[model samples]
Target: MQPGQQPQPSGSYYPQQAEQYAVPPMIVPSQMPMMMPGQQYGQPPNVPQHMLRHGYIAATFGTYGETAYCAFLKCGLGQIPLMFSIPGCTGAYTVAQSVLPHLPYGWRAADGAPVILLDCIIDQTRGPVVPQEVWMPNSPRVYDQHVVRAVLRPPTFFVHTDGSVGLPLPQILSGNFAVNNANAPVDVGRSSIHLHIKIHGYTDRKRQFQTQESGQWIQLRRLVGHVGRAVDKYLREAEPDPEQPVPRLRIGAGGIVPADVVVVGVVHVSSGSWMPILQLTRALA
Candidate 1:
């Protein structure tokens, strides 16, 4: 094939064009056609074009339509490993030749999901085309002198509602604020700052139950923003600011105090193919 002349289609992953191969199967390095030293391979090959030469390269999605594996190869040529993200999805693939060459051999996810390795190095003497984020604390933005230790202070209960007595229950939580009263409706103002919390137990008489009654504890998840709003709603009368302020929530007579406040997340993995060259580069890195 002449330079820049597109090769014939292998197959496609799309349902309508199902016969077209998006990415050709991986080729073992030992099986690759060997060229003798000083032989005319012409000039040093462009990685992406070299991928094109192989035929049936694959790709994943992005904000733009059907982005092929260009960036993956770029990372390989740069001797860097990177992750390719396709939003709202666990797997996706595209078709093209040579695109697979950038991927690594024997690449598989430790988590047993599909992944690709990209390994090729580009000459950086020409200057980097893109900059990576590097953390530098003393880089002209802020100058630091010495380290100092500040004593941890107790939670400040600034907003106390009238007609309600506030009792700071120190035994309930160490270095944290807790409010309790036998009767007069305790309004613990949500501190303006967000907090991480877990409800160890609660006492209720009429329901005749406590965290001890049921051995099982209910796990509650809360976001900082939502928790702030809930606190504002419950302690409405105690809010220091009235404009755009949320009220404190009132815990009902029979309602249970939340078990905990930390949020949990899940990661789902689906099966798919990734560029082998990209996979290889990542593995070596």
Candidate 2:
């Protein structure tokens, strides 16, 4: 093979092709190959043109699109280590090839499914031509500052009808998050969100609060962006703006609330219609 010349297909090419790969539109690192030490920025020949490289993927869906290892994630319930696969290619690099994200414990119910926000860090610096597959499937944009991201299964891309997430990609997530109410009639676009998240059983300091002297705008910084729009890019472009409300994790003057009380909220996407807005509510039974 020569520079810019595509390599021959591997035996599993059909399976690979059948397995659709989508890079979320969120913050992604440059797909341009990162040069090895002592090599000129664009010079060739650190290795053989015929040399092949291997990469890995942890996915919710699989060959033939059966939601293979992510069976439990279908209804947004259950827990298990994510499924991953490793394969070789003529030009690519792999880091944390065995990485897998675990679902948070105890989030299943009937009234609704808990919205799980996801993200990850993807670096594709070793491929010369194509982006070497550092992606988070369902996240919104591709910012180097923002980690890579994704969702359980498309379930229609699992994105809101309004496109709140920005772009679509398959997901395995990371980062702090929040949610929208599942039973809402519409987007329920709330301007403010306050969540009493379960930190830990022993966490004595709960309920975030700002000093009386602080302005409401100043308080917005303490709270993370809405997790329902957890993967959206608008939150990252600039400093926190109070107008775009976020989930405030307050520390009450009375101290921490009991951890046994589980609170979970999510923006729901069903067959077609979607309600992506969120508000604080008790965990569904």
For each candidate in the order shown, give its overall lDDT on alpha carbons: 0.21, 0.22
Model 2 C-alpha lDDT per residue in residues 138-180, reported as the tens digit of each score: 3223311121122222111122223122111111123222222
- Stretches off by above 4 angstroms in model 1 are 1-19, 34-42, 53-67, 70-285
Model 1 — TM-score against the truth? 0.17
Candidate 1 backbone overlaps, count: 49
lDDT of 2 at 32: 25
Please give the range of 10 consecutive residues that has the lowest summed lDDT in model 2.
48-57
Q: Could you estimate the TM-score for every candidate?
A: 0.17, 0.17
Error of 2 at 99 (Å): 16
Superposing all C-alpha atoms, what RMSD in Å does each candidate have to the true structure? 26.4, 20.9
lDDT of 2: 0.22
In model 1, how large is the Cα lDDT of residue 270?
8
